[model samples]
Target: MADKAPSGRILVVDDEASLREVLTIMLQREGYDVETAADGATAQALLRESDFDLIISDIKMPKITGLELLRFVREHAPETMMIMITAFSTSEDAVEAMKLGAFDYITKPFRNDEIRLIVRNALERRALRQENQTLRQELSQRYSFANMVGKSEPMQQVYELISKVAPSKANVLVTGESGTGKELVAKAIHFNSPRRDHPFVPVNCGAIPETLLESELFGHEKGAFTGASGQKAGLFEVANSGTIFLDEIGELPASMQVKLLRVLQEREFRRVGGTKDLPVDVRLIAATNKDLATETKEGRFREDLYYRLNVIHIPLPPLRERSEDIPLLINHFYQSHAGHDVKISDAALRLLLDYPWPGNIRELHNVLERCLVLGSAESIGVDCLPPQVRDAAAGTLLHDLPEDGLDLDAYLAAIERELLLKALERSNNVRTRAAELLKMSFRSIRYRLAKFGLDVDE
Candidate 1:
């Protein structure tokens, strides 16, 4: 099954001594490590003695029937697969064998290739099940709440909010800049909720074409449109009894917004061209990078729809606002992506902390991956960083001096003015945050604003 010799341990049981030897020799020749038993009782003794990947047994045997052995295997070692051998005239018994949990049944006088192929398929299925179990365990560990990674106060608040709202049936609105892990938070909520065992479907509102978005969210009947070939279930139907995350919800067209609101209000929708309304029990989680409240005020977004979706708002702070979390996030990404053998130098870390990550966590991950791939040294130093990050750290607070010998006083004033504007922009025009960015008290910043004839209200 694994594309190599010594595939797996197999047990061959039969009443006929010649058939047992033939099966044992044939399985061994095909690269399986095989053991033989004379009957069901002996096979049970062998099962107790050791584990086997597969067991091929004759249905009619003295002491115990293969069906009885099937029950024993199901009770004791459910993972071991059982294949039944029945007489060609007893086809009904083969169907009964399947019902009793037999992996497959081979009629007597069967080809050797048929038995080999069935065994191979059974072993492959076993291997696949084991792999899926391992992968699920790993994913559960990765997305657990404790692994969210942030000691900052704002992040702690986020965790608290998530813990409180995740188990509820409320529709959640997540607001954050691009690459701020809005979808990750949505997943955390869904995976930690009661409907975790069900599906979690994610759709990007901005990515899909507006013309198809309505049908994409709601099912379409056969011949619904010019190119409609057959009936198709939409994402809402697909996410029944689970969660559906709409990312970049702000980009949803006004027409679709009305439909989405109707679904949220009525808990049901009909197919694009069908008369029957389908009810869904999906938990809605919407995310956006835009200010929906402002959009509502500006008439760009519907006020009622905004209120409906914003039942519980979770706002994520930008990386600049939570700079303290930078080191932890960097270490997390490094440990996750790069091998533990490599280390980031103190100088490099400092530069990374100082750099403005406009692209947020996603950008930081890319930068670290680039450094690890390009650098040969064990330690990642400032030299390993890209020009944008390295040069940003090296740039002075003031602009470069010109060769024309400009006036010192005017040059200093211009530098101060530009830095103030930049700080204001970075802080979303919040006076207090701008003051903090420039390392000035709020009162001092106000006095400077007054001197520049700038309106504080603006």
Candidate 2:
């Protein structure tokens, strides 16, 4: 017998005092602290006095039945687990007892093995559920700072910049190519600052129409317009003491830009039909994929508003420029869906790295997910990619290069170097695989590796 067991309290209830004593003694021998009750009313009274981990009760009693005890346990002590015992165990009563929250039902004269197994499994389940909840809480704490996820170098810089400016109450402009997780950065700045726990509203400038933009930002009074139903609070008013993320700020209409600039200069705005000004306390975090500077020069965007929003600028590099980050991002996504038998092959991963990602990180994540859903071989591969990417790879590998009037020897060597690079890439940087593809001995390939500035390890 295993000496070690988890410690918990048990309450035993039976109409017969001898049966109650027997069960209490059995549980106490099994290492559980035990208590006894003569009837359901007594058990209910005991529950009001102190907490117990488990309850074992008889099905039939004169004052209160075990079924009533199960209901009482469910209502009064929801945390405590219960088991029932009965000499006459009908199928419906057994099922009904379970549905009403009895952990298990034991018929008269049950084996000790049956009793031990049921109790052990139920206790283990309770412990396992608590352990799982603790792990999730710890994970959430590590992943979120101001409700944002960023551990890479680019994100570290963003973190520093956000910290520096979030305290000053400056109008911040966040610029990033689309799908670069800019909104996540915005929320982090807002939640980590002093205005945390307040409303943090988000509005898309491009998503809302120009005619309704003013109404959405500054709100409207009852009967303000043709379809006016009642007074509505604007994002600026609702987000008082917090922040508003104005996404795609470059898409704001030129006319609305003047109104936005006025609000930035002063801390107030009037409703659409009301004359009185509404005072607001808001921190603005704006993001755009467009070039606001060029738009300013072209008279499409206001110079004054552009400069105000650019007080603390944060620019996110496109995915191609941050190719080194793919592995990190892949692992992050992997951990989010853990315990699955998922993996990426070296050849498939190398193909992902080599491709110039036009749609950025978002596209990469989508592609990998699709491959997992569609693939049967358990690994993502080059064949899994779309035709456009395959075509691009083919073109790059065979493109004509400048000869520069080199001698025959130099020209041939240059060609060989290019071919070696292509071979290594096709084999996921495996020298042995490259040698097999090139129809050359592995030793011969190694000897020629340094002449072309190629490392066999690469």
Candidate 3:
């Protein structure tokens, strides 16, 4: 679901300058920001001056061998990635390098694509470890909370409640914004509690209609409904010894809400149009974005049902509240967007930090995907952005631009041409919104797009 790849620096060392240059070029072609050294000694000196995400060195270097460098990396730069390179092509060297903490190994005359893939894979592993650390940190932040990503004060309260009731069979109600990742918290509780290995089945209460929601939650005998040609086990039956996540619980219709409340009170329910009362042994974890309490007060949602599902509550904050992590999220996306060491400009970083992000984490990711695809160049700039992003960036980082009195006509014209053609390409000669972003909406933009005769869209 996430496309983050490791994108830190890598130290490439070889006794031969030509080989070093070739390797650097190959990696740079893949969007990696690379630096090089001619020998292990030089590589070590660079390590002293800077930190690297990973290292690639020749096994037989001038003074210090790759193995020695690996030893130094293991002790001094424990997190650094060390890849041993050699002409020897012996498994012994590969085994030795790995034992000494080398992330991977490659021999001389390596294909360009192979080198890129290996570095990408190694860096991805490193990124995962770093992200896991972030999750653990969140645990402490959301301390006593069930599994989730944020550790804000609100999350801490949720954590406290989860810890108190996870071991018991009490029902829970988790509330938050739509993208708040509540299901993650539900699984965390089920897995952490006594039913760690038991099944954790989830059902969206809002997705099925009122007439079918009951059957969906409590199974149905054959021909119970128009489409019920065969008997089907309901969610509760499937999750008998485990947990059931009732997502969007507020959307449950009033008729079904009454039936659901009965089950919570008696721990039993009969299938639709069936005479058998089936007892269920399942833990309930329900979540919704609505304030069921307010709905109850307004006589919209049921009060008894609200009380039944509200025994333990957890709420997650929207991503903007955790805006401090925007940079980390940007880096996280950059690493996973399927490229080598794609770097973001400081201006872009500043831009991402200030966006209102109405869609929260989901919007941030969408913006990042657009940027990655369109701005694969070494550096991303304000002009590279979609207009809204550029506008957002300008809003947050506005300053008095000293009148330099320069005509941006040539630059603007070239960009307009590109956008027009891009639009034409997408519509197969039609100019539309997709093309508009590529070209722009100004009269001058349309004029230039015409100048190129790119009127692809009829």
Candidate 4:
């Protein structure tokens, strides 16, 4: 087979012409684009002109030294990898070069295999760093505030809270119904916090069995229990210096709740079957759908732990309550999941908005995905929606009338209040826009608002 194309570019700098020629030929044969410079000064000139993945320089050189070049690379092009070459007697200088940020060092009498291995390792490390940086940027963009996707008053309040709390060390408790994107909010907080560069560990408190829950949180020593062949670090350890998201936190049993509270209070934990208590510095972000305060009152959850985790509470609004954001969410989900140019008709959108989404945003995402997959390639009409959603718009005005009959005036007033409140919410509490939505004159809207005791100055 033909020699493969060069995978990385390398610059070779040495005082000896023979060593430079040999290094260049060897690295070239190994499929690297090799450039040669007789001294550190020449190498510096070359570096100023173009980029190289790795630089190999001898410790002793004229005009400038290898250490000087290493310092220059560290200051200007820190991402570029450097390897120092030195005589066996001057190996101490190689150590100094390593301290100055050289990737590694090879002695003058180094073997060909040694040179090749070091070069390959340096290039691989550089590639890994680049990949990690790219991934971090992508994650930062993915979880940014722009991705939250809502303009409703409640959601705007949530956005503001997230921004204010993200910089603090206080634990946050995100409460919302299931499928309300609780975990997404957790991720948003983590990625936006100072701990963004560190790990963001998420564990579902309800998914793991009670038997292994402790070990899973606090790790285990070798032979701690059955199948414990080796020592293990826990999620708390993994999340040290970062944030740990405990989803479905209400599902934590009473025993574990006490232990978790201790961790929160003391900032330390002992591994299962271990004698020593290890300190941790992780920020906790807990989420649950259940009424945790009620759980505390019922004695199902610990009171102290509830208060500890509820230092910064973020209550997410359900989809039905934020119906004004439905159209934006629909477009967001469609652009995310639909790969084709598919459109949704106004009738289909109307039914979607009318349906009470008990499962919230997750349900809407799944429904949109289903529509994109099963509905027509061009557009989605009312017939394309699920039967339940379609039928929501067709439901009877009243399921059954009581035999005694209700007060007509009271019923009509309640209806009016509900529509007025909905219109106000949809218009972000702007009375004039709300009046326009209800198709009522601004003066009439003001009178009704006063009569219902719902008046608020603009």
| Clash count per candidate | 0, 0, 14, 0
lDDT of 4 by residue, 1-458 (tens): 95343279999989899999999999988889999999888888898999999999998888799999899888878999999988884577888987888899888688998998888889989999999999998897788765798999999999999999998999999999998889999999998999999999999999999999999999999999999999999999999999999999999998999899999999999999899999999999999999999999998988899999999999999999998898888777666666544566655665676578999998888787777777765676554566567555445346676485644554455456557767888988899999999999999999988765568767
**Once model 2 is optimally superposed onto the true structure by TM-score, how far is the C-alpha of residue 433 displaced, in angstroms?**
26
User: Which is the better candidate, 1 or 4, if ranked by TM-score?
Assistant: 4
lDDT of 3: 0.74
Local accuracy of candidate 3 as per-residue lDDT tens digits, 1-458: 74544567878888888888988887876667799988788888898999988888888876898898899888988877777887767768778998877888898778877887889988888888888778755643442343244456665666677778778988888888886668877877876677655678999988888777778888899988798898888888889888999999888888888888888899998987699898988899999999889999999899888988888877777776776766666665675666444566554555555566777777777877777777663445444556665455334233454375322343344444455555666666644554465655655545655564433335
Please write out the lDDT profile of model 1 over residues 1-458, one tens digit for every residue: 55663279999889999999888888888889899988899999999999999999999998898888999999999999889999974677788889988999888898998988899998888787778878766665666566797899999999988889988999999999998899999988888888877889999999999989988989799999988899999999999999999999999999988889899999999889899988889999999999999999998899889998999999998887788898788677667776454566655666676678899888887887787788743567654577677656436446676575545543344345556767888988889999999999999988876654444564
Once superposed on the true structure, which residue ranges of model 2 sit more than 4 Å away at CA? 1-153, 338-342, 376-378, 400-458
Rank list by TM-score: 4, 1, 2, 3
What lDDT tens digits, residue by residue, belong to model 2 across residues 327-415?
A: 76766665564434446655455556667888887887787666656653345544465555444444454456536431345334444
Best by lDDT: 4
lDDT of 1 at 405: 57
Assess every candidate by TM-score: 0.74, 0.57, 0.53, 0.78
Rank ordering of all candidates by lDDT, starting from the highest = 4, 1, 2, 3
Residue 210 in model 4: lDDT: 99
With candidate 2 superimposed using the best TM-score fit, by how many Å does residue 428's alpha carbon deviate from the native? 29
Candidate 2 TM-score to native: 0.57
Error of 4 at 428 (Å): 48
Give the clash count for model 1.
0
